[model samples]
Target chain A: MSIGKVGARKLMASFAIFLIATGFGMARYEIKDTPPNLSRFESTIASGGKTELSGIVVDEPDEREKNTRLIVETDNVKILVYAQHYPEFEYGDELSVSGKLKKPENFSGDFDWAGYLAKDDIYYEMLYPKINLVARGKGSWVKRQMFALKAKYLSALSKVIPEPYAAFMGGLTVGAKRAIGKNLLEDFRKTGIIHIVVLSGYNISLVADTVMRAVSFLPTVFATSLGVLGIILFAVMTGASATVVRASLMSLLVVLARTTGRVYEITWALFLTGFFMVLHNPKILRFDAGFQLSFLATFAIIFLAPRIEEKLHFIPKKFQFREIFSATLATQIFVLPLLLYKMGMFSVVSVPVNLLVLIFVPATMLFGFITGAVGMFSALLSVPLGWISFAFLRYELGVVETFAKLPFASFNVSNFPLWLTLAVYILYGFLIYKLNRRNTRKNQVA
Target chain B: MSQKRMAILLAGFIGGVLLRSFLNLGWAFAGFFVFYLSFR
Candidate 1:
């Protein structure tokens, strides 16, 4: 009646497969069932007149250069409002908004603006809305406090660091709501280093590594506990958005694996995390590009980076250059096809630009955190650290700007087929299989 | 299962999801059926 090890393994694998299959099935069913009903809004929007609605701001105000985007919810429907930056809004402010309510429209490119918003159940938008704050503090107490703390952190960063650099530092440390300017954002896109600015798993992983090393003098259990606590605090500090939560969970698994010396177990944990995320929000599997890229980049870092490092004999190991190089290469390779398909832009100089910038990221983040923390208390005391952080930020911006201006820096691939993207990934899977088989055979011989 | 089979299985599951995303539900079901047959 007892099952052998192979039998047990098979049973576990079968269970995993069943669970994943169910998840996929559920996602497909949800997508098929829940089409957005815009009939109610459409009738009002088609009137071509100003509509007045009162609602509570449901999410953080997305601060851009000239305007701030807010999601206002009343009853069951949520509307995206673009309000002037002068009268800034907080997360939980109740407001009466008057504007021309219109359905989200697609831009010139292949971007499906409506479909993208549909993932979040947002169908209508108010452009340049006349918003009056009716009340404040309508959201969860914890979120309001988190947003206030984030605002104070950004204000502290600005006291010491100049514009653009201050904004960039804010992005690196706290996922600041402020924009880093459209031109600079385009440069980041062209150079393919945009992930650095966003609160991605890569950034969280770096933070986790820094925490682990900082507390390495302590016992393994204590250090791991501290590292996890730091990650949780970080997630909470950043408003615990879905993206940050996912990154924190992935980083947490990685820290646990390193501390427990259980690398294989971490792989299952990683997959389970992904499975649960998809199960919770089936729309993200198809609609959310950030979700897709986060998982793919993490997977490449975990599995492909080491294999790539073995072949990168020419790269020096000093300063962890080889490790960074392998990681950058693996992630770029793994995510490229999807990126090309989703955003028809491809950066030819992404590798060189990444190498030039990534080496300073860890140090920049360290000094940047110090600058903000100290600046909060005394701006004068933080100036020295702020200057050091600014130098790194300036260099990174210079590299991105210089490389982005090159004639062959990037190219546009219009209408990339989905089948081709799938084909590329399948080829990748085949190559990985061959590589794993060869490694196993070599181990047997050894 | 062998590593190759495992990779194929994983790819098949992903392919089902991708097909469901890009195409219709029917294609996704068909994609899963093909992989199920192959695995068998």
Candidate 2:
């Protein structure tokens, strides 16, 4: 259904609010000062000289066989410090690193590595830093605890499952992709199922469902709230859930608007969400892809998923497969051009491979969670679940490998200009608006 | 869990993920909005 004319006034108000919020956020971002500590090192860092720097490990280390990459926030600057292999450091652990801090430079090819790092306000990097653990628990208390739980869960999962599979399960459940080798990782990207590795909603639901089930013995309200909290953490880990919360809340409002026959309320809600989010972090409106996508995808699901689902009515709605399929299709339709512009590779097999893998995602994730949770208590009790998870993992890998190996499975496109990407989206947004207006007219006729 | 609860939960989960995927798509479109406005 199109946007109801009755909500037109509210929509206008929301649009005005969004614009004001956006302007304010952009201004705030521009005027924002660099961290006090970082400002001290600005000249030293800019000189491109080798020097020692100390900072708190603001995030979990990306553990690769070659090196562990740590996002360290010094007094002021955020730097990517690479150490020799895993450095036995966790999040919130402060470290004194003796290494040359070099400014990020752009890659020779189409990829803008420097710009990417800059997106998160990181301008410097260190390779093979000499790291000394200065102190424990120097960052957020909540994040420290989350990382600890994550580490424990990961260790438990690894103990029960074998290598490669264990690493894959870690990626599937908690976005621990450092253990996943480059070749296999490429296979996942080629098959376009790499999203599963990240802490996407699917992964969250898997963990949340398990958490809910395990705590089912508890009071109903408590269990449900706990499950919701699990889902929220999934967003937080990605560093994009702040936007997700805004999107979710706004969409809920829009849904409410429809039910109450106050379509304007949805538009008003959208603007207000945008305004508030921009007010909180203006850079998100301009820089964060996750934030942008959350809004678009939410809109599509709210408007388009139902239409697509009806078209696919032949497919049994059993197990919610139809909904999954439709949702995937709808999101792809909206994101394909952008994905192409960013990833610079088009996987022709993305849809089918995603469908094949996504159906098994929840199952695989569920089994993986059960294995991890049960393993925490007893390896003997968790063995059966581990085996089941392994089975799902094997099947998923088979699908990904098979599709990735197909002749011309993906196209490596380069030099796709940003202007073109923008044009495509402008057209897309216009199309959505036109479609909404047309549907409004149709409803009026009927 | 009963079949009904199972179905509902699965649907909700899938729906959540779909919303996520769409947001990702919208993100891709941000470039368009900025450029379009500039040119216009």
Q: DockQ (Cα-based) per candidate? A: 0.23, 0.03
Interface RMSD for each of the candidates: 4.8, 13.6
On residues A17-56, what C-alpha lDDT tens digit does candidate 2 reach at each position?
4444333333354433222345556677767766887789
- Runs of candidate 2 with Cα error greater than 4 angstroms are A1-22, A32-39, A46-48, A205-229, A232-278, A292-295, A440-446, B1-40
What does the lDDT read for residue A242 in candidate 2? 43
Residues A114-190 of candidate 1: C-alpha lDDT, one tens digit per residue: 87787777878999988899999997887787778778878988998899999998888787767899999999999
Query: What lDDT does candidate 1 reach at residue B37?
Result: 68
Segments in model 1 whose C-alpha atoms lie over 4 Å from true places: A1-24, A27-50, A212-229, A239-243, A255-264, B1-20, B23-40
Per-prediction TM-score to the true structure, in the order listed: 0.86, 0.77
CAPRI band for model 1: acceptable
